[model samples]
Target: HVVTARVVVIIVAAAMVVIATTPVRSMTVVILTVTPVTTLLRGECIELETLGESGGEAFCDRG
Candidate 1:
């Protein structure tokens, strides 16, 4: 009984380590893989005031 309990504890500890490390390793890979693709899909963004005209200079077509 004691030996079985020790084996179970060791198995649980190893599983815990695997589970903890899996997502961390996956996250680094996922971020590195997804970041550039997402950025490419997301292009430039012009604010509402900046799109047309503000106090500074005209951006839209004045003609």
Candidate 2:
């Protein structure tokens, strides 16, 4: 259930970028893996990724 929520968040963030006309510096959102790598639910890590300024690619933020 939690992982599902993460996907939803990423979708919403992406949509915002599409709807915005003015150039945005960057957009960030959390996404999750489909299959759990851990037995515990909390083990599902949220991947925080940022979209590139060009709007064609994304890079993982270490911070």
Candidate 3:
């Protein structure tokens, strides 16, 4: 089966919309094995960093 790039993009956009609207704390199912949109505020960049072996941070603090 050949999956076109356009289709994939549309799917991703739809998923992002869903994530953006839903509240983070109430979400049960993980979106693509990662946390849904919460750390990133409107007009912010999403950044992910590893603090320690088991510690990590996801935020939208650009600077």
Candidate 4:
């Protein structure tokens, strides 16, 4: 029982490490609906977005 539990724990830890270090490609749309006359943080933004597995090129519409 102890041996099986250890093996399972090792496998789970390995998977966690791999997932944490891996940069998985995914798709998501970022929409910025900010009024021309609004809050102080209305225009500028430091966005960190990701792309899909198909390739590069971020799908964003900053308007």
Point to the candidate with the largest lDDT.
1
Ranking by TM-score: 4, 1, 3, 2
Model 3, position 31, has a per-residue lDDT of 52
Stretches of candidate 3 off by over 4 Å are 1-3, 25-63
User: Per-residue CA lDDT of candidate 2, range 1-63, in tens?
Assistant: 467567656666665665474335323211222123222223222332122232212221211
- What lDDT tens digits, residue by residue, belong to model 4 across residues 1-63? 345446546655655565566536211111111222122122212121232322112213322
What residue pairs are clashing in model 3? none
Could you arrange the candidates by lDDT from highest to lowest?
1, 3, 2, 4
- Writing each residue's lDDT as its tens digit, candidate 1 over 1-63 gives 345446546655655666577976755655554465334323211332355435212322221
Question: Which regions in candidate 4 have their CA more than 4 angstroms from the true location?
Answer: 25-63
TM-score of each: 0.36, 0.33, 0.34, 0.37
CA lDDT of every candidate: 0.45, 0.37, 0.39, 0.33
Backbone collisions counted per model: 0, 0, 0, 0
Least lDDT summed over 10 consecutive residues: which range in candidate 3? Answer: 39-48
By lDDT, the better pick of 3 and 4 is 3
Instruction: Kindly give the stretch of ten consecutive residues in candidate 2 with the minimal lDDT sum.
Output: 54-63
lDDT of 3: 0.39
